[model samples]
Target: MSSGKYAFTKALKELRFHHCQTSPQSQAARSFLVRAYPTMKKHNPQTPILIREAQGIEPKVWARYGFGKERMESLAGLDEKAIESKVTEMATSEPQS
Candidate 1:
């Protein structure tokens, strides 16, 4: 699926984000989601995008690919731009062996 600047690849099945809503470490992830969530959801309406929050957990992002394969990256201490770049890359690229 293609949206203005994002073209999600077919290999990507779902995206999951986990963060602590009240922790400073989650600040960037929250900010990135605020601005990017709408565009992502609009473009890939069928894909599951889940956001989970807790009280003191570390922030992270998960990308699930075909055949139940998955990859995860830490988001703790990352800035909004870095988080965006990581998510864009994960969302657009195919699973790597």
Candidate 2:
């Protein structure tokens, strides 16, 4: 198998592992699931077209799960600190449980 295919396979395995570990009630897990489930349902493509287009390789399972150059770049640019601060502010302002 090629390096790209190997990497894609590795990533898919890791995602599945992580997803299995996520708790339904945890805010972080719920947030991730909420975002991911819809995308998975809506797209339902066998392979990531984005990766295939960008890498000139056959689309792999990992790509179907949304790993690609566009996603990588967007993730790299994300300001985690800012996002955390916003989440913190919103949580604090909301009525307590």
Specify the highest-TM-score model's number: 1
Reference-based TM-score of each model: 0.93, 0.23
Give the per-residue lDDT of model 1 (tens digit) for 1-97: 2365456788999999999888888999999898899999888888999999988999999999999899999998899989988999999889988
lDDT of each: 0.89, 0.27
Task: Give the clashing residue pairs of candidate 2, or none.
Answer: none
| Residue-wise C-alpha lDDT for candidate 2, range 1-97, written one tens digit per residue | 1222212222221122022222222334334344444453344334232211222222111221223321111111224343233322322232222
Global lDDT for candidate 1? 0.89
In terms of lDDT, the poorest run of 10 residues in model 2 is: 69-78
